[model samples]
Target chain A: MSAPDLADLIENLRRFADDRDWGRFHTPKNLAMALTGEVGELVAELQWLTPRESAAVMDDPEAGARVRAEIGDVMIYLTRLADVLGVDLIQAAQEKLADAALRYPAP
Target chain B: MSAPDLADLIENLRRFADDRDWGRFHTPKNLAMALTGEVGELVAELQWLTPRESAAVMDDPEAGARVRAEIGDVMIYLTRLADVLGVDLIQAAQEKLADAALRYPAP
Candidate 1:
């Protein structure tokens, strides 16, 4: 299967929300909060691991699954928020990268 | 220009970090922490706004720009973390969404 893109995820999320009558709960503020919660979950997965251990997290099947799930949750909420706000995720990211180039120039 | 995909962002981020000699700092823990920080910033943008107000936030150019930038930062860090961990982000998200569908069935 072809890799899913941001637009595809947004569409799937919209349908998921629609199916569950979740639109009312998907406001920008709420989505942002959900995104935060997901990111926290993701961080908790690696919080106590040493850098080397953290890098090797995916070597363990169970822990790797949990970490992957959390990453998915974070992206789902983030993409949902951008969708509600009419922000193009890729465009926003591209612009931010461009802006960062100036702020942190290569030595 | 054509829309940028997740791989493109990952490649660009890799180059960005490489150019600035910042890979040493892009550990899974560090990237996850950065993701949390960016999510915090995104949440702060909507923290005090009412539902209706939060929905209308993007109507204000200044607030919209900040919100967009925060979203960008969140994605950038997230993509970076996933990359460092050697996780396929699109696959992770797809699997999680599939799992969530089973958990949150339509009524």
Candidate 2:
């Protein structure tokens, strides 16, 4: 199957919100906050685990599914925030890497 | 300026790793763990805010900058995780919405 596009995902999210009359509640600030909240849930899954143990989280099927769902939650909110703010997630990521390159140049 | 592309961002990250001989440390498991850690940092910024207060987070310039930086961190690690696993983030996001649609049909 073909992969999804960023625009399409944003559109779907927008429509989802519009359908639920959640547009007003989805301003960038609120969306960003919600994004962080979802991220917290994702983080909770790995809390207190040693790096090795954290790395093995997906070894358990149920835990793996939870992680994936949390990832999806984080992604959905993030995409919505970016959309509200008119930030292109991929583009912002590329620019951040460019900035990082300047900070940590090849040795 | 033109927007950045996912493939380009992935390439830049890959090059950054290769330059540091850090490829071995960037396995999918490690990246996923790092992603959650960064997400935790992002969540900390809005930890105690009520919805209204949370929505005003960006109203404080310093806090706004911190929030943005944390967002950048989360994005970078997430992108890296997807790259390591050969998952197309945009596509995966799209498919996720499709699955969500089936679960939460429009009313």
Candidate 3:
């Protein structure tokens, strides 16, 4: 896909969901609960794995899909959540970048 | 302790660290490095736990202290990082709560 207007990316995602008649299924509580569920799934992906294993969990063919899919699911829900709440995630992200720069100033 | 002004709560945490002359130890990169370490520990708290087991991981005395302490460490470092970067974590939190309310409007 052409680079989504970064500014309107969340809006675009919401519109895509709307086009599919999925907005009804995206009630805030449902979205939040879904977000939480995705987090759990992400956690589960690394569970029982040693640190080295956990980091490389993304490289495994079988488990990699599960972990990557869960991350994308979380992002999708987060985008929609931010959209419904009128949060410009990009702006928040940009602000955070600036803040991080200050906090992580080069030595 | 007197209720910390919600606005300056992060600042207060920074002050607490400063009082102990720990600022030198809280360089942003170090704090971020430390934050990631805490996240690893937090994950470790629930690693290999069944869903039920994960939810109650905090109930185990031995593991509970570790989980709680790591969470507290994460929070402390976060507060300090925000302060040094001129971010008002309380404000960010408040904004997030407002966003959540919008996303999760009661049925």
Candidate 4:
């Protein structure tokens, strides 16, 4: 199955917020805070593992599931924050990637 | 112009790593740590301001640029992490969102 695109995800999240009457609470500041919290959850999943082990985390079903869920959470909040700010998430990413390429040229 | 999609972003990031021969360092753990650092930068942009100020951050051209770039960095690293872990970013997000919807039903 084709996964949801960024626009679809944004629309889905909008509907989710609307359903709960949460649009008022979804300010950029709050969404950023929530994004931070999700990032923490994502990090917690990898915090204690050795480099090799962490690299292979998905080999273990349980830990892998947790990591996936956390990544999902991170993406969701980040998308919402960008949406609220009227930033095109993919465009922003492309611009930053271009800038990084110049700063750190291939040698 | 259409912005780059997730696959394009992932491919671009892979090329960035390949060009610098940095693929070896891009373990899931390293990516996660890098993701956390980027998230920290994103948070710093919004951290000290009052809620109202933070909500209106994008109104200031300078702060808005910073926030946009930080969001880009976070997305880039998160995308990389998901790629390295063999997780489909959108699919993972869809799953987590579904779970959240079930847990947080409309009242």
Per-residue lDDT of candidate 3, residues A54-103 (tens digit): 54554577875555454445455555654554444433433443454467
Sorting all predicted structures by TM-score, with the top scorer first, yields 1, 4, 2, 3
The residue-by-residue lDDT of candidate 2 on A1-107, one tens digit each, is 25565667788899988887888898655776677677667668777666666566667788767766667777888888766655567766666677888998889
Of the candidates shown, which would achieve the greatest lDDT relative to the real structure?
Answer: 4
Query: What is candidate 1's CAPRI-style docking category based on DockQ?
Result: high
Local lDDT at B84 for model 1:
90
User: What does TM-score give for chain A of every model?
Assistant: 0.94, 0.93, 0.73, 0.96
Write one digit per residue (lDDT tens) for candidate 3, span B17-62: 5665667666544544554554455456555666555445545778
Clash totals for all candidate models: 0, 1, 1, 0
**What's the residue-level lDDT of B106 in candidate 3?**
39
lDDT of 1 at A6: 65
Least accurate stretch of 10 residues (summed lDDT) in model 2 chain A? A1-10
In CAPRI terms, model 3 is classed as incorrect
User: What lDDT is reached at residue B57 by model 4?
Assistant: 92
Question: What does candidate 2's lDDT look like per residue over B1-107, in tens digits?
Answer: 35565677778888899998887787655776677677677678877777667566777888767666767777888877666645566765666677878887778
Off by over 4 Å in 3: A1-12, A19-25, A103-106, B1-107
Error of 3 at A8 (Å): 8.1
Listed models, DockQ each: 0.81, 0.35, 0.04, 0.79
Cα error of candidate 2 at position B59, Å = 4.1
Error of 3 at A10 (Å): 3.8
Per-residue CA lDDT of model 1 for B62-88, tens digit only, reads 999999999998888988888998887
Docking class for model 4 is: medium
